[model samples]
Target: MRGSVRKILLVFSFVLILLGFWFSTTNAYTFIKGYMLFQTDQTHIVNSAEEPSKQHKDNLKQKKLYTIRPNKGENIGNLLIPKLNATLPIFHGTDEEELENGVGHFDKSVLPGEKDNSVLSGHRDTVFRKLGEVGKGDTLIVETSAGSFTYKIRHVRIVDKDDRTVIVPKPRATLTLSTCYPFDFIGASPERYILVADLISQKLT
Candidate 1:
């Protein structure tokens, strides 16, 4: 009787372990699918414009440039890092769902290409996994309805998560990308990785 009970317990434990693994794998697959949907929707926004070339050029020439202030959860634009080959949608706020889908722009900062710092944040495991791989002089491009702003990386640093100086307003057009440090960490990280770049060019289109 004792041997039979031991065998049954071992089989039950094995089944529980397999079930746990299945649950974890399913969750990860679901999350990836959701993120891919976000990317597809965002890409369509830019590629599906209805205007013709002449009208688009005329509008670009005549339209007055101003800052775009997006509400929380709004899709502001797309961020592209050429070196990292990362193209992700930029959302308005850094809330949980926002970062889970793509990068978020700080509402307090100016929009990209504006005169001041434009702060963007992303999750280390998601859109910004290759952020640390970017080096100085790499280009960061932000394409928006207003225009496209290109920035060249100038500095990179690892700072405490509470550091506010990195996002402070600057005198010139600056871009800051933030992600949690130790990209492979299993749990919450205490440090942040920052990439600072200066606007090298701008195209109003």
Candidate 2:
């Protein structure tokens, strides 16, 4: 009976070890994939008008071509937060797969450099890990194939996770960056950290 009990205990220990290894492996894979996706170039965009193709071709002659027709899950642009010294790829959607790769643009919101709220989100523990270090008067820059826009941080606030007021349309062009609150939390965060900025300038490349 003693020997049988010893064998069962050993098996249980081995199973626990395997579970831990699997967990680590999965998380590592996710992080590595996300890193690679962010480093890759994104030259695509959804064209709402005929100017897209013509614009892209024209830019191509200048060796500045951008704005290819985008499919789902394509890279859109890059988001730079000077205060945090962080630059992350911005994808088209806020879904899990897209967010896993980098910061994600809310598709329902206006595009960057446009005349409405352009909302971007990321995981607090990853891309926006240093977000808390940012403050008012800082700058946020978004670079896309169409152009680069500079925003001046006007406000920073912590809101409930479900708050929709933060993303409401504004009379002036704006940029909104969001992430889960309590950056060091172990599980699903219950609050959101919001960074609101206004478009101060833009340069069409």
Top model number, TM-score: 1
Q: TM-score for all predictions?
A: 0.67, 0.65
Could you tally the backbone clashes for each prediction?
0, 0
Summarize candidate 2's per-residue lDDT along 81-145 as a digit string, tens digits: 87777889999989999999999998888788877798999998789888988879999999988
How far is 198's C-alpha from truth in model 1 (Å)? 0.2
What is the lDDT, from 0 to 100, of the residue 179 in candidate 2?
94
lDDT score of model 2?
A: 0.86
- Candidate lDDT scores, in order, read 0.89, 0.86
Query: What are the RMSDs of all candidates, in order?
Result: 29.0, 29.3
Q: What is the lDDT of residue 33 in candidate 2?
A: 93
Q: In model 2, what lDDT does residue 72 have?
A: 52
Lowest lDDT block of 10, candidate 2: 41-50
